[model samples]
Target: MRTSSTIRTRVTVKRTTRAAAALAAGALALSLTACGDDDKGDDSGDKGGGTKQPGVSVTLPKLDGESLSVAAVWTGTEQKNFKQVLTEFEKRTGAKVTFVPAQDPIINFLGSKIAGGAPPDVAMLPQPGAIKQAVDKGWAKPLGAEATKELGENYSQGWQGIGKVGGKQYGVYYKAANKSLIWYNARVFENAGAAEPKTWDELLNTAQMVYDSGVTPFSVGGADGWTLTDWFENVYLSQAGPEKYDQLAQHKIKWTDPSVKEALTTLAEIWGKKDFVAGGASGALQTEFPASVTQAFTGGDQPKAGMVYEGDFAQVNIGETKAKVGTDAKVFPFPAVGDTAPVVSGGDAAVILKDSKAAQALATWLASPDAAAIQAKLGGFLSPNKSIDSSVYPNEVQKKIADALIAAGDDFRFDMSDQAPQAFGGTPGKGEWKTLQDFLKNPKDVAGAQAKLEADAAAAYGG
Candidate 1:
């Protein structure tokens, strides 16, 4: 039920300003003070035993007996953690909030709901294209004044601009991902005497050393084609530079451009080697994303592979293993392929779909640090809201990732495939996903791959 369309917007991520950071710090300090004074019998109503949650001091209008629903494509720990944030909102505002499970290509899922006249009150959209689609369909509503004010006070200009369509705010980006990280098992590195690589060639050398030590060097989730796209994006962004990256993302240049060929040729260095990949190419082609992470971290000193490349959220999968992050498990920035390492990010934006007062209240609360701080403390989460204190994150690894993302400021790029039209970027078994999977199976066919990519992109972009 998902409708496909061309996406032309250029989504850029920037860093938080010093002034916004100061405001965030002040707000967090005030919340900490409120937490300290909980025992003083403050009138903040506590529905269950008067126990107050820390980092939740946002003042919301009382909507006792009001009912609302939120939709997002989150499952497992991600869903559980977000629900805790919603529960806190319900307790604080006396509004009953329900979590609605959504499917991939959430726009399609929402299309069905909107047609049925039962769209959720609020939806956490994962792509800017989806937001634009919703707005074009006239299903998205502008954020209320309170929410807009909170957004300006807490977020950077770049982050604010991502949610704006035709210069009107429609979304609040609540969760962010630092996608340019390579996570490795500490034991494997120590056993192979391998150091973290700083450049593309060095990474190959490290992989060779790991392989020489009789361990697979990398775990790739080839079954999920989006994971393959992530691999290509990191390499492309670092090697081709941001200018070329922007051009390709917007389809201003053809997929057959020299830059694309060069990036693919560089990726061929690793993909061309069968031993360097976990389970070989065939085995990897069967591996799913979670299994890919678990394979690299679950086997103690002899994990299936030595490393995995993914975002900050990979910690959620690492949690399912016995390896302790930052100790048994460690990470480094993606190695530089050109001048410097790349910083590619992805995030979920909360947008109002139904114009009810309670729905608007929820959007306003999501923009506040109070809501973000609750999830940030629970781990496997990062917030662009500069107001949330870094100490809330459970460990040094997540903290560093969050810091690096904010530090990137204007240099950072949103996920490339995500910015493209859905037919070309978001769909599985099609477009870049399938094309890259085919390239992985036959890394030598650079020309054929380029031709197919250009054809698919041209059709998707309506060239």
Candidate 2:
């Protein structure tokens, strides 16, 4: 969307379980350890007391001598940072905390554990949809009053609400992502003599300019339909404001709505162009997400694409490549076509599975500003906790990104596709991914794509 400064203040949220699940599955899984030195950030004393989540309780309860088990999708540095939070919690409460990898299909993993009569006390779920699913299955327990209060104080009411599924509060969102961002190679932009695009028109012009410079304009990873949906959602949010975003997300507005078609049509203006994309449209459909990012940064002997559109978390992938971030690699807000930068976001929520004073105490601590600030000092992390100090972040770019989010406040919308059903959102050979892939293959048939989306969404959401 527009510059990061143009963050909107009005917020609306309506997302399908399928869409949230699908989006979170791809967007939220990475740990920065594989990327760079996380310890690079300033890890000074917790001077203002222990690192906390924003807002709520003045004092956390002492649950000393108790042992607790926690699980999350985080694998590397993220787990390390979280352990830091847990370590603080343990230090204060005298409880033992263990971090476990909550395997993908995290639900299935938890199910087996639960069936065996030993599910982790707390689980960090990738999607609000997953939290809702666990809540529905009766696996998730409500947060304690302190956790609930801190959740309300630290996060926006919308975020507070999302943590609640089926009228009961059960989860606390710990991390967030600005999905409406396009990460590109700085050299490519400089070489092409093109500034980062500030609008959709500029984006097209930059794409053409880069293409004319002998390299592909974009590294489209259509091999993964999830990436395709992120492309659509950003455009849709910018074209349509938060209200329509919520409506379409909830299926309150059908995918066949004229607005949906318009978004697709607008997307066509770029995707419709021949060789406007890397590997042409056909080759793009086969390129997976990693290849897409690497394609943008790839230099030396192989061909390189100029740009890639992904979330803030893409830094992990960027770290994997030979390119240098914030210099060789830079990011701009996804160019806006509508009134403001279409800010869509997603994050993992921590929910308690089995209730105990220790579990609730840990959950409460996780929701505190102290807990968040501890991890914030470590690079590559963003928290929605409003009470956290901006200075906690390691760099200006991150601060700006975090500020864009904080400035947006309640106005931010969760990724719409993430609100749909699993079969529709996350399921590969079916739903939006396949349909969007088809549409990408032939973008001019906007109506055809709209019809397919509606049909699939109806079946999945209706059921």
Q: Give the TM-score of candidate 1.
A: 0.88
TM-score of each: 0.88, 0.81
CA RMSD of all predictions: 6.6, 7.1
lDDT of 2: 0.70
Please give the lDDT score at residue 303 for candidate 2. 48
lDDT, residue 82, model 2: 67
Q: Where is model 2 more than 4 Å wrong at Cα? A: 1-65, 103-105, 279-291, 300-303, 441-445
Clashes of each: 2, 28
How many residue pairs of model 1 clash at the backbone?
2
lDDT tens readout by residue for model 1, 1-463: 1100111111223112334323222222121110111111123344433233453445577788999999987777778778888987787778999999887667889999989989999998877877888899999999988889988888888788889999999999888876666889889999999998878899999999999998899998888777778788878876777688889989999999999999999989988887889987788888877788889998788989999987767777887888777678788767778765665567888999999889988998899887887777777777888787776677766665566556544444567777778788877688998999999899999999999999999998899
